[model samples]
Target: MQHRPTIRFHGAAGTVTGSCFAIETAGGLILVDCGMFQGSKTEKELNYRPFPFDPESVVAVVLTHAHIDHAGLLPKLARFGYRGPIYATGGTMDLCSVMLPDSAHIQEYEVEQLNRRNRRRSRVQVEPIYDATDAALVLTQFRPVRLRQWQEIAQDVRVRFWNAGHLLGSASIEMEIGQGRDLLRLLFSGDIGSGFKLLQHDPEAPAGFDYVVCESTYGGTDRLDTTDIGRRRILAQEVSTASRHRDGALIIPSFAVERTQELLADLIFLMETGDIPSCPIIIDSPLAIRATDIFEKHRDDLENGDLLVRAIRSKNVRFTQTVEQSKAVDFVRGFHIVIAASGMCEAGRIRHRLKNWLWREEGTVLLVGFQAAGTLGRILQDGAATVRIQGDEISVRANIRSIDVYSGHADGAELSSWLAGRLPVRYAVFLVHGEEEAMEAMARRAAALVGDEHVYRPRLDSAFRLDADGPVDISQAGPPPRIDPQQAGHRDWNNDYQTLLLDLQAELRNAADDKARGVVIRKIRRALEE
Candidate 1:
């Protein structure tokens, strides 16, 4: 008799970020996509704790894609004593070269800021979770796998990669569980894309599987904005509207990966076809510029029939690096487009760009990506009149708009199509990488498609066995899960911290005198210490 596979949901079971799944079988512990948590403080703090399983116990890591939320924590895994070959596509490995270092740099800078604040009040200093050194060290162990080809990474375990159409080198993993009479197949849809991608190909139509684990990022609602052409028109219209105002900036909050490149290609095609005026376009993200170069390195993998190539050749576009150059844009007075990263308006130079243009009625602050709840992008998208930035409330008089057609994540309809096939499952489908509302909604739909008894939404740290009894949660299993909002310690700490920050900022701003301001600042410091 052969050993059967047992799976544990370590992350991304209850939240939209931090995707890590462990499979113990064939005398090997295999991991998939060790990502860091983002969003509110409670979620972010989870990244500081040790991985639920011992890092050294894992034999190999199969990365799904290079998105920070999908692959961000690899360096941390390396730092904590995981020394194994990580597998991904060539494009993903190339991206990790720039992305990992940048992630580490951000961690170092943020930790420095935290320590500076700590030193002010004599609180114990905290260290960064990981550093650039660890990130760089992790890059030395990359093993590339070709698409649609099954490669054995462990004893009796084989995996194949399929283009997910979400990003460059994005893959939906297909795994063969065992051999002979005990064989089973499973599929992991790694961020399936809605059709009409600018660079990558359409998502692979899924095949037969004994069990499936899929991401339900946009499962709560069926999306109306669905095509690439329709989305391009919206962008052109926004730019054209901005152009009519003579000297205004159309600030686009975009991610640095495929999203930034895709927008440029569309804008270039639009400008060439005279659908929009030829305005000066500025890409202010160094990471995006570098990623664009990498995309060019793998132009054969791009879709759109050479459209992206022409976009890269356009003369109206310019790439800016350095803080001084980005600041100088503030003094420019003309109809132009500025695309910046930190797409959710959480970090990066987009905030600076927003501060410059958000007050102008002529400009447009276009959101072309998913703005998670509680993020500044979501606030703007919801039509907030003013938003606080850097402790000062800034007026948002500019036009704010969004078009979801550019989303990399497949919506509910697309997911249904991808999941609907001739495949008959022996066990169930596990949903991950979505908000609770989204997962529950998708679970209902999935149950309707693949029997209600066969759809499982496992909690974080939940375990299931793929034994002779088929895939089922045995009463005897892994640790009981401690998941989001339900986890005891610091449950409301995120909300409380946010409210405290806002209150302190208001008090400091309204303070009548320097003595009053100092007192308020001291109170803020004390509250933080407490």
Candidate 2:
């Protein structure tokens, strides 16, 4: 019997986060990006469950970038007994050194809080997926690989990194497996960046592959084409409008890596050139502050490197590295700007800031990145009258503003163009990392480019057999899917429950009288009883 190679869609299939994939060959199994799930509580619960695959069997782990969704679960992989070499670019390795540890700290801290409440309620305690110590240990296994150079990771398996332009160290992984007549050429596009990104160059990759696993993050939406000056102008207007309220603060929920750095450079430039009024710009998250330092170290490699260096050195910018210092921002008077982490407002200091200022009409929440479905950021972006944050229902009175100019992911048109660039995908193009609608939209575009038969939309935990000709869907031949495909990217029961509670509160308040309110309550009680 001949050895057959297979590719498994372990994560980032029907959803946008938790990007893990397995490539199994005769030599061994190689895993790409063991990441953590974010967003709805149901989706997040998947993080605590055991990995569907055996970590110990993985011979190598290839990382694309250090974003929490793509690389967050690495420590958990380490905890599960995988000690293989993790390959990434030098920049990715450096960023992960700080990011992975921070993710671990967050898990430990959040778990501790949950356990404290559980103890009080006489409920069973839970452990974090991985701790800081595990995060630290995983760092030792990192093996940095330079871009555009092919390196052998396993027997008869070689990979080359291409600049993805998504983050500081992001890259697309191209692999050459087997030898001679049995050779397989595959490409995994790890979060391609929008060509219009302010701080990075356009995404780059080679063409001609047997199989291409691509991201469909911004598949259905197309942003207006804007030049660098135009992007800055939009930001300036937003800042200028918000700053007019001298008594309020502007809260920017930003991703700590590239997004924060890009905003800082643009904000400082606007201030120095008088495009916008100068104000105190506070970096509230310690992770953002530390990541900023790393960005500074590699400023020379970034576009507009001088602007970034200037922004970091600017006196108007302040970095709060301690808890006390972060808390002190609350007392600061006047119109100031704060950039905090956990960009989707899922966790981190941004939530605290939002809780404090969300109810103030004068305050403004400027969202500059992608907000995944079921996250607090998405809920606010969708315009909720009230949002629950850490058990407190806070009224949404702040000016909620969002701009697409700063998004890291390329929009639908760009993604289509990217797929076209990698033309003649002989076997198949597996679309992942997008919601159902976005994926469907991209599937149409992909079909036009590579024939409808060559486009595949894989579900979570689905697997495909790869051979000399093409891919065969062997999903049914394997174990059952880890999750229901229908629930992959949609808001789960937790979101529904929260929405119901809020709706009930509004109904009671708007009732004609106590009698009407009692009728509403009784109706709900009757439904519950049934």
Best by lDDT: 2
lDDT of each: 0.82, 0.92
Q: Could you tell me which residue pairs clash in candidate 2?
A: none
RMSD (Å) of each candidate, 1 decimal: 3.9, 1.2
Model 1 TM: 0.90
Model 1 pairs whose backbones collide: 247-334
The alpha-carbon deviation from the true structure for residue 72 of candidate 2, after best TM-score superposition, in angstroms, is 0.5
Worst 10 residues of 2 by lDDT: 221-230
Q: Which residue segments of model 2 deviate by more than 4 Å?
A: none
**Highest-TM-score candidate:** 2
What are the per-residue Cα lDDT tens digits for candidate 2 across 1-530?
Answer: 16778999989989999999999988799998988888788789999999999999999999999998999999999999999999999889989999999998888898999899999999999999999999999999999999999999998899999999999989999999888888899999999998888778899999999999999988998888557888999999999999999999999999989899999999999999999988999999888888888888888778888889899999999999998998999988999999998899999999999999999998999998888889999999999999999888899999999998898998899999999999879989999999988999999989999999999999999999997778888999999987887788889999999999998998999999999999999999999999
What local lDDT does model 1 show for residue 371?
72
